[model samples]
Target: MEVEADEEAALLSRPRARHIKKRALKNKALSVSFDEKDLKDFVGGFHKRKKKRRKEAELLVQEAQRRKRIEARKKRKLERESVYGGAVPATDSGSDECGEDDEQDEGSELVTSISGTATYDNGDMKVTVTTSEISREEDKFPSEKMQAAGTQINWRS
Candidate 1:
């Protein structure tokens, strides 16, 4: 019985040893063939090139940020100049025709026209200027009640 148990143990240990040896041989076979000098040179060159690329990327980002800041400053300057009608001395000559004030006035006029406070008569014979108050009163209440009270009341007083 002792000999039989030793034989079984030997059988199991033999396969494990063979498997380890095969794995070691496979790894050895797959090893890359590079001289020490060549390996070091390649690694050093790769790192140097990587560092240069990273520095270039950082410079590009900084340049973009600078340009963005300059553009924003120019926009703010133009806004200030246009608001003050170029009266401020710090205004740039190139920004004189920005028309920011005209745009604002045009926007206000559009709003007024939409609300019926302003009228546009394009050489037509019949020109009607519908007041906002009248339109609002008519919308809020019936025409008869608005005409009677000169105003509109939605709720009973």
Candidate 2:
């Protein structure tokens, strides 16, 4: 117990250790007073960088939302197309007599066989569709004849 006490006394009585003296000297050097202008000069650039990063983050979030909306629109379009049987006319060669008859006939046969039945909602509701049931006037507004006559003018608001 005496030996431990003497060791403790010796440590306390000694001059400050190297690390302690360095820390004390640094603290004393930094004790000088500074005004608002000095503080502003030191912190000005930090605020500008913070503002730039905040704007960039907001733009990224907006882009993500726009992408999600576009994807949803595309998915809905595909589903609607599937629900309507888009096949019978293609199989019947009498529909459109374009110059390339042979190639079109082969392609039409494949498409007609594949799209024979139109199913919706994972086959929960199944409906047999035929091209004759679909009305051409309902599908296309302002018929080709009207467009050729220049009845509708193109206007940009």
> Which candidate tops lDDT?
1
| TM-score for each of the candidates | 0.35, 0.32
Question: Which tens-of-lDDT digit does each residue in 2-34 have in candidate 2?
Answer: 999999999999878554577676677546787
Highest TM-score against the true fold, candidate? 1
**Ten-residue region with minimum lDDT total, candidate 2:** 104-113
lDDT of each: 0.57, 0.54
- Model 1 misplaced regions, further than 4 Å: 1-36, 89-157
TM-score of 1: 0.35
> Distance (Å) between predicted and true CA of 48, model 1?
1.0
Work out candidate 2's RMSD over C-alphas.
Answer: 20.8
Tell me each candidate's RMSD, in Å, in order.
Answer: 18.4, 20.8
Cα lDDT for residue 67, model 1?
Answer: 75
Pairs that collide in candidate 1 are: none
